[model samples]
Target chain A: MLKISKKADYALMALQHIAAVQFGDVTPGRVVNTKEIAEEYNIPLELLAKVLQTLAKNALIESHNGPKGGYLLARRAHQITIAQILESIEGPLGITDCSHEKDGEFCMQRENCHIRTPLLKVQDSIAQLLNNMTLQDMMGGTPLITIQSPTAQGVER
Target chain B: MLKISKKADYALMALQHIAAVQFGDVTPGRVVNTKEIAEEYNIPLELLAKVLQTLAKNALIESHNGPKGGYLLARRAHQITIAQILESIEGPLGITDCSHEKDGEFCMQRENCHIRTPLLKVQDSIAQLLNNMTLQDMMGGTPLITIQSPTAQGVER
Candidate 1:
């Protein structure tokens, strides 16, 4: 199945946890340990720790090494979109290799393949939705609207 | 970047090759060799051979060996959607684990997470596109159209 890797999944969960506590006075700018975050979300400790480290490496979240150190959002929750979190963990958001503009030189069929065009559209729609959502938006408990209804005609996006 | 796996990519290339010749005098049951398909599309012979075997295993295509042997579509080209070819190689088309209905049971945040809903919409959009596109349609070189332009978004399906 096409899936967000384990890294991306953990990153989102961690971001949401950080967002949930952002408004609290005591924990403001404080290091949030991976243990605490993993326990809160019921995620595997070792896996979540690795994921947290990855987020830190990507600059999506800040980390410290001393006694009270853990992780924190590098920027404000509102400033971090789901797309950034995803990209931080999973690399670029693209459906087909041919859809990537960054390395278009590699695909031999780039000049004439018709499938690339529609797949690009699919990628665009997904990006639009992800870009519109921020960690804060998710924390705000906003109702996510369906882009296509189960009964609706047309494409799923 | 979000990308289709090598398997799905090869499957599509192979299907398109088959569709291009579907209208010829050759019977639907005729077998086409992997080497010919690899040569036609300039794909690696070993890789194309493995992909063709996978397609046959998934019933997307059928194969035969011996003096007069190769591969043939298990069904009419028009009846085979792009989704089937992709799923055969990549499994379910999903952006995240939670996007899958079956995996919902295992998701830790299924009850409260907001991202799943919109992500599901994106998944549906992708599914619809794949479902609508047939091997025949791709072979016919239909001009692809999308409701939105590619650059406006950032999410990858």
Candidate 2:
């Protein structure tokens, strides 16, 4: 399991596109509309548009409406984390239905399944790792940032 | 899309069952049969049997046949990692089909998807976190262990 939705992926692709362009451009938050991103990344326009809508609604990105309109990061690139982007596009991040206790005791699996508690721990670890990563870490010209154990501070550059 | 397969879930359930029992008095490396695990967890017998076969084959656990035969941890409970158990049941973990470069170059998505590289990094972070955790870390009686950012030198325990 542990898969990211294509919608989230597209959202990331679109954001990375804007982040890369804005890294040094004159337009500090200038819109870079969906059409241009979809074409450059070969993403399906309709699908990417939906993803963009979710991000815009979440205020992760700003959407413009005019003919010259497009999308731009609502915040600085480093202010955006992959976890926030994923949550905006795909809701909560859980690898399993029973990852949270509120999933209830309706199923028989609940009777003997001790995995739920541990699975939740797994979910937490994953969410922590995702939350730690900023979009700036993955954008073009930046080396992919590595994960530091939640407690490890500034050890692995 | 981040979901663990039923087989992997069952595998974790079975391992946890064995680990729980082993945590108590009885015998070290005590074997717990498939029928018992399957019935207790309401897992499909045939499916869990296949999952156990893969785990046994991968040496995550040992299996025996005949009436008194069943399965036991291949090593100490503390030595078995969740990543090992999951990978044994599900093969290599790839969050996306294109997670690995060997996914082939046939799809157009592979040609232009900027997300793949960064996604692979995300996958690596998940895998590393899982790899760092031993089955004993999740077994009953042990308080849920918190993640120590991968380099903290074991502070959180």
User: What are the lDDT scores of the predictions, listed in order?
Assistant: 0.68, 0.74
Overall local distance difference test of candidate 1: 0.68
* lDDT score for residue B71 of model 1: 79
Off by over 4 Å in 2: A26-29, A103-107, A111-113, A141-157, B27-30, B103-118, B140-157
Instruction: Give the DockQ (2 decimals) of all models.
Output: 0.31, 0.39
Taking the true A–B contacts (Cα pairs closer than 8 Å), what share appears in each candidate? 0.42, 0.44
TM-score of each: 0.73, 0.80
Model 2: CAPRI class? acceptable
Residue by residue across A1-157, what tens digits does model 2's lDDT show? 4666777778887888898776656656566888888888778999889998888899998877989898877899889998898888777776776655464444457766556665666677677777778888776544455555522332222
Report RMSD (Å) for each prediction in the order shown: 6.2, 4.8
Residue range B47-153, candidate 1, lDDT tens digits: 88888888899988777778778877788877887789888887778778766457337577565554565555555655665676566555444332334435422
Best by DockQ: 2
Q: Which portions of model 1 miss their true places by more than 4 Å?
A: A24-31, A42-50, A53-59, A62-70, A74-78, A101-104, A108-114, A140-142, A145-157, B24-31, B94-122, B142-157
TM (B chain), model 1: 0.78
Question: Which residue pairs in candidate 2 have backbone atoms (N, alpha carbon, C) closer than 3 angstroms, thus clashing?
Answer: A1-B3, A2-B3, A3-B2, A33-A70, A149-B149, A149-B150, A150-B149, A151-B149
> Which stretch of 10 consecutive residues in model 2 chain A shows the poorest summed lDDT?
A148-157
Candidate 2, residues B1-157, lDDT tens digits: the string is: 4777888888888888887776667665567899988898788899989999999899888888998899888788778888888878777787776665553455456666656777777787777777777777665532225433454222222
Candidate 1 lDDT, tens digit per residue, A1-157? 5677867777787787776665656666566788887776677999988888878888888888788877777888778887888887788887787665664365754433545654565567567667766777666554343333121233422
Q: Of the candidates shown, which would achieve the greatest TM-score relative to the real structure?
A: 2
